[model samples]
Target: MLTPLVDPDGAPFWEYAAQGELRVQACAGPDCGELRFPPRPCCPHCRSFDSEWRRMSGRGRIWSYVVPHPPLLPAYAAQAPYNAVVVELLDAPRIRLVGNVVAAPDAPLNSVDPARLRIGAGVKVAFTLLDDITVPRWLLERT
Candidate 1:
């Protein structure tokens, strides 16, 4: 599996995942609490430099997905035919995260059958440690 480069702005997200918590960065401005992803130093909503990590429910629905074809990079070729999904968070509808829908937290990317995936299907967050970082994956709500 490929590891994500941890930048200062997104360090907190990885830290929370390591503790089994899914959180999103939000503006800490007194009157503005807009959430933002790709954690940045400033808020696009209120132009605030202050920010905080807000705990999320980790529930979402598949908003979109695509099953990749062959000719993938070596690092991902082994996981070919797997689906990459865009999940829309339940609590924060506007916030969508990109990941794979797997059968288990540590399961391989192709663990879930491609035929089983569908847009609008409910999913819950599952975490798996990749190297020193714990990353979040999604599992079907029913199975």
Candidate 2:
């Protein structure tokens, strides 16, 4: 299993996921109100320092995606080919997020056929508890 990489800014997100909730950063700044993804200390728009963690609907479409070729990083060599997708959350228009789409956390890339994935395919976020972090994964969303 590949241990997820986490940072200080993303800690709150994972912490909330551990509680079975999906949270994303939202700018509370008055001037430049916007939703930030991957979590940030300030709004990328106005550079405002005010921000807060807000829950998301966890529903999005596969705007774009890619299947990594063989000989990936040492950590993902076995997972040679897997989907890394950019999902546009329905709840936040400008807020798009990127992550993997695995059948299950423990399964490898080979677990899900790459050809089966398509652009604009609807997907819903799912979290698998790994230790204390809730890494976002995706599953096919019914139309």
Candidate 3:
């Protein structure tokens, strides 16, 4: 599996995930309370350098997704039919995160059947440690 390159601004996010906490970066500006993804040093809304990591509910809906076919990265080729999804957070609708939906936190990439996936489906965050890094994945919510 390919691990994410942790940068300074996004390090805290991975740190929180390691502790089993889901969090998003938010502008800490007094007048601007907006959430931002792909964590940055400055808030795009208020143009303020002040920022904080806000805990999230870890629930979301599948905004968009794709099932990659073979002829991809060597590492992911075995999981060719796996799904890569963009999940819109329930609490912060505008903030969407990318992850794979799996049957369980530590399940294989293709653990969930592709036929069961649907747009707008409810999902919750799940974490698994890979090569010492805890990464977030998703699990379909029972209707």
Candidate 4:
């Protein structure tokens, strides 16, 4: 199974997801409160080391998506046709996250049909335990 590489800077993200909460790291600098995904050790905006993990509303839209054909990593080949999505948070549109869109929180990566995905489609955060890490997945929001 392909797993995420949890580094010290990004550990908190996985920790929050494991607890069923979606959180993003934000710079705590006085003049720069930039929200960043794929957490980093220092703030890119103000180059500040100070930061905080802020809970998200779990609302977002599909900014982009892809269904890999063949030539995928060996571990992911079995889950071919899975939709990988880039979701732009409603509150922080600048911060986008990469994840798979599933039918339910615990569903497999192929649960959602690839043809059903669309850019600009609304989605919400969902967490699932994959291997030893809890990762965030996306679910299409119903009208």
Which candidate comes out best when scored by TM-score?
3
Per-residue alpha-carbon lDDT of model 2 for 1-143, expressed as tens digits? 45667889888888887776778888888866677876879788888989888898888888888887764567777666777889888888677888877776555555667777888888888888655566778887752
Q: Which ten residues in a row have the lowest lDDT in candidate 4?
A: 71-80
After superposition on all CA atoms, what RMSD does each candidate show versus the true structure? 1.0, 2.4, 1.0, 1.3
78-139, model 3: which lDDT tens digit per residue? 77679999999999999999999999999999988888899999999999999999999999
- Model 3: worst 10 consecutive residues (lDDT sum): 71-80
The C-alpha stretches of model 2 lying farther than 4 A from their native spots are none
The better candidate by TM-score, 2 or 4, is: 4
Q: Per-residue lDDT for 58-82 in model 4, tens only?
A: 9999999989887277777777778
Per-residue C-alpha lDDT of model 1 across residues 1-143, encoded as one tens digit per residue: 77889999999999999999999999999899999998999999889999999999999999999998872667888787798899999999989999999999999998999999999999999999988889999999976
**How would you order the candidates by lDDT, starting with the best?**
3, 1, 4, 2
- Models sorted by TM-score, best on top: 3, 1, 4, 2
All candidates' lDDT scores? 0.93, 0.78, 0.93, 0.90
Runs of candidate 4 exceeding 4 Å displacement: none
CA shift of 105, model 4, Å: 1.3
Better of 1 and 3 by TM-score: 3
Q: Native-vs-model 2 lDDT?
A: 0.78
Q: Please provide TM-scores, in order, for all candidate models, with all chains considered together.
A: 0.96, 0.83, 0.97, 0.94
